[model samples]
Target: MKDGGINFISFSVGRYGVLKTFSEQDMESLLAAYLKEHPDALERMHFVMLHPFRDDDDEMSRSAREIHHVAKRMKFFQDYVARNPYDSTILINNPTPRSKLYLDFVHYVAALLGPIGSYEIFK
Candidate 1:
């Protein structure tokens, strides 16, 4: 991305449910290293919260526990963004729209970058 002169990076944490896959420290360390390599990209990073859900029938039996789990994950994101050297944006896209999987993300990103931004999907 740095080689391509792309400064912005958008990442969604959990697409299915709020499950802890990586520890906060692990993610922070990884991001810190990448940021160190491309210091200018720090302010352009965006962490998206997409499709936050709870598997009530199986994984999480209690509604209270599910809510707590989601809350904890959200806090994790908040803390992660807060620790960054540059102010980053957090886009909470709860109940993710189907269009987002299609062309919406491209359009959104294009809009953010204005007329100069362009994206092409590779098959």
Candidate 2:
């Protein structure tokens, strides 16, 4: 179920049916668990998240850029996600302006480079 204007992962609930928000600790724990299962997960993560951009269009370079933008937006987005995690409804504390600006910046970048994630140029 899409909410707001972004896709979200499913939310986990705590005791008494309260939804659980993603936390740094939880992310770390999940990473640790994944590393426990796959010892080379750190290298894999670096390959995806920190790999250099390529001149040609490729999934790997696109993945890296996506991760970069996602990390950049996380500064404001993490708070929004923490509000309800999976809830996409309008928030009491909305960062709509920031989000709008960010979207515009994305479009600017897209025009400079190329379309991303189904965006089409208006003119």
Candidate 3:
């Protein structure tokens, strides 16, 4: 959603279990590369990492692990943004349960990327 001047995009991470494959290092490298390539991308993008719980194991360990990984990624992003003062970086958490399938996940993602008038849900 893009409201006033913000464009939001809702992307799912754990829908097909792809997030389970993403190591914390992979996330860090991706963010770093994204920032480096676009330079101004951070200023325009508000990234919302979403992890949807699957079953019992997901509810307990997997979800916690994913959150921890995301937290670390956010720390790296925050540090980078601090070093590059000109860039605007926003990272928000919106971990939901896969029980809602993907709808709840989309809503959570939208909330993270706030003040947006339009949004696209990418699975």
Alpha carbon lDDT of each predicted model = 0.33, 0.40, 0.38
- lDDT for 38 (candidate 1): 46
Model 2 lowest lDDT segment of ten: 14-23
When sorted by TM-score, best at the front, the candidate numbers are 2, 3, 1
Ranking by lDDT: 2, 3, 1
lDDT of 1: 0.33
The backbone clash count of each candidate, in order, is 0, 0, 6
Which structure is stronger by TM-score: 2 or 3?
2
Inter-residue clash pairs, candidate 2: none
Window of ten residues with lowest summed lDDT in model 1: 43-52
lDDT of 3 at 120: 50
Q: Which pairs clash (backbone N, Cα, C closer than 3 Å) in model 1?
A: none
| Candidate 3 accuracy as TM-score | 0.24
